[model samples]
Target: METIQFIHSGWAYIVLIVLVIATFNALIKFFGNKEFDAKDFRISLFTLITMHIQLLFGIILWFTKGYFDEMSVGEVMKNDAVRKLAVEHPATMLIAVALVTIGYSKHKKKLVSKPKFKVLAIFYTIALALVLYMIPWNQWF
Candidate 1:
């Protein structure tokens, strides 16, 4: 459980870096009217892959922590920190991942460079915002 937690925590850095890179890349390219090529595709794919890996580790950590077993929903909800960890964090992260997945899928369907970058820019930016918001700063530092 500790190992899983450690991995989840550590992998979050990778996810963040990749997500930032991907989001910025999309935004820059879209605004600059640059062509979407293999490098762009690879970056986006890598971002998706890293996020999914982190999500998997997070799910394992959540289950191993036994949050639900330890507290009733009401009890969990009543505590802000507990609520954040047990419910809000996971839920928000799940939505973020979904957004990234959707962005990747949508970008793939676009035949033009600008539209692909635009789709990726919008979705990845929103997802990155959520991820930044949900991360536990105190615990991490």
Candidate 2:
């Protein structure tokens, strides 16, 4: 379980970096009116992979931390720190991963450059925002 935590924490850096790069790439290329190229495809795919891996680790870490054993919803909600780690972090991270997933797939199906960039920009940006907002920065850092 400690190993799980270690891996999750370490992997978070990669996830953050890749996601930022992908989002920025999408935005820059979209605004530049550049064609979505193979590099773009690879970056988006890599971001999706990185995020899903983090989400999997987070779920495992959450369960091992015994958050479900929390006696009641109110009890869990009442404690701000525990609540942030146990509930808010995972929930928001999950949403972020889902958004990245959707963005990757949606962009893939688009035939043209602008729509591809638009899809990736929209969802990946939202995912990045959610991730940045929800990470347990106090504890993790």
Candidate 3:
């Protein structure tokens, strides 16, 4: 369980870095009217992959932790910190991951550079915000 937590924690950094890079890249390219090239595709794909991997690690960690086994749903909900760690974080992170997946899929369907970048920019930025909001900053740092 500790090993899983450690991996999840470490992988989160990569997920965050790639997500930021992908979001910023898309935003810059979209605003600048720059053509979407192979590099852009690669970066977006890499970001998606990293996020999915992090999600997998997080799920493993969550199960290993057996958070619900320690407390009832009411108890978990009543405690702010416990609620954040046990429920809010996972739920928000899942939503963020879903956003990334949807963004990547939508971008792939767009034929033009602007539309692709625009889709990526909007979705990734929102996803990044969610990720940033839900991260257990105090625990990680």
Q: In order, what lDDT does every prediction score?
A: 0.96, 0.91, 0.95
Residue ranges of candidate 2 with Cα displaced over 4 Å:
none
Backbone clashes in candidate 3 total 0
| Residues 1-141 of candidate 2: C-alpha lDDT, one tens digit per residue | 899999999999899899999999999999999988999999999999999888889888988989758557788899887788888888888899999998998899999999999999999999999999987787685
Which segments of model 3 are wrong by more than 4 Å? none
Query: What's the lDDT for residue 136 in model 3?
Result: 93
Comparison by lDDT, 1 against 2, better one:
1
Considering only N, C-alpha and C atoms within 3 Å, which residue pairs clash in candidate 2?
none
Per-residue lDDT of 1-141 in model 3, one digit per residue for the tens?
A: 879988999999899999999999999999999999999999999999999999999888888888789899999899999899889999999999999999999999999999999999999999999999999999995
Q: What's model 1's TM-score?
A: 0.99
Displacement of the residue 53 alpha carbon in candidate 3, Å: 0.4
Winner of 2 and 3 under TM-score:
3
Ranking by TM-score: 1, 3, 2
Q: For residues 19-138, what per-residue lDDT tens digits would candidate 1 score against the true structure?
A: 999999999999999999999999999999999999899999999999989789999999999999989999999999999999999999999999999999999999999999999988
